[model samples]
Target: MTAVAHTSFVIERDFLASPARVFRGWSELALKQRWTDCHSDLAGRTHTLDFRPGGSETVTMRFPQGGTCVVRFHYFDIVPDRRIVYGYAMELDGRAGSVSLVTVEFAPTPAGTRMVFTEQAALLEEGQDLAERIEGTREGFDRLARELEPAPARP
Candidate 1:
């Protein structure tokens, strides 16, 4: 028999950059590639982003041990530098693994941008790595913090 699990998580992060900058980190394909891969062990194969309502984003990666995972996201709403809501799905070696509703919101704070990321996921039999998933997501945010830092002054 097939099994399914449900989980929802919220992660908050503070970035020392403007809300626009923080939003750009997620909205721009190139910038997003710099920090979105929480699983360093996975080799990214392709990434495409369309940052607008009715658009979609997709990424394909190869797991170190074997197999491939593809992530698909369909944009449902976008509010410039403030918020984004999307539907997410994941496939492993062409088999459906999970589906989720994801929302990310950004707000300006004295320190900089305060971002909240929320994901509600339904995990199919092949997507039972909830703990690992959360850890990877948290690590991705840590990488985002580093990516948001201003470039070093040119020599």
Candidate 2:
């Protein structure tokens, strides 16, 4: 029988943008796609996001070395620019891997916004690398910083 390993983690970041702007990064399909899987090395990727309660988001990535990783997020609750709760999971090479319940809360800060991300996950047998997951998320947030930048002036 395969064993299941469970883990939980919280990641927080301060962005120099309003809560609405930060929420837009996750709620807009095209914008979300820009920062979603930026941390991964991929040969190709396709993303779809419905961005509403009961809707689902999916990202399929093909690796250069020959493997496919599919990630899915099912939105359960959304509070506009305040919070979002979702179910997250991963499938790699046809094998179901980790399943997670994720909650993201956004609050106004003195400078801009503080975003807190909390995730509780159940990893399938041969436990997924928790560090990799955390590091990958950190990297994604780094890329998201670009999303917070002010738009360049257009001539």
RMSD of 1: 1.9
Give the residue spans of candidate 1 off by over 4 A: 39-44, 152-155
Best by TM-score: 2
lDDT of 2 by residue, 17-73 (tens): 999999999998888887776635789999988989999999999999999989999
- Please, what are the lDDT tens digits per residue for candidate 1 over residues 1-155? 57788899999999999999999998888889989866667755789998899999999999778899999999999999999999999998999999999999999999999999999999986538889888889999898999999898998
Those runs of model 2 whose alpha carbons end farther than 4 Å from true positions after fitting are 39-41, 151-155
Deviation in angstroms for 68 in model 1? 1.0
Provide the lDDT at 139 for model 2.
83
Per-candidate TM-scores read: 0.91, 0.92
lDDT of each: 0.91, 0.90
**Residue pairs that clash (backbone atoms under 3 angstroms), model 2:** none
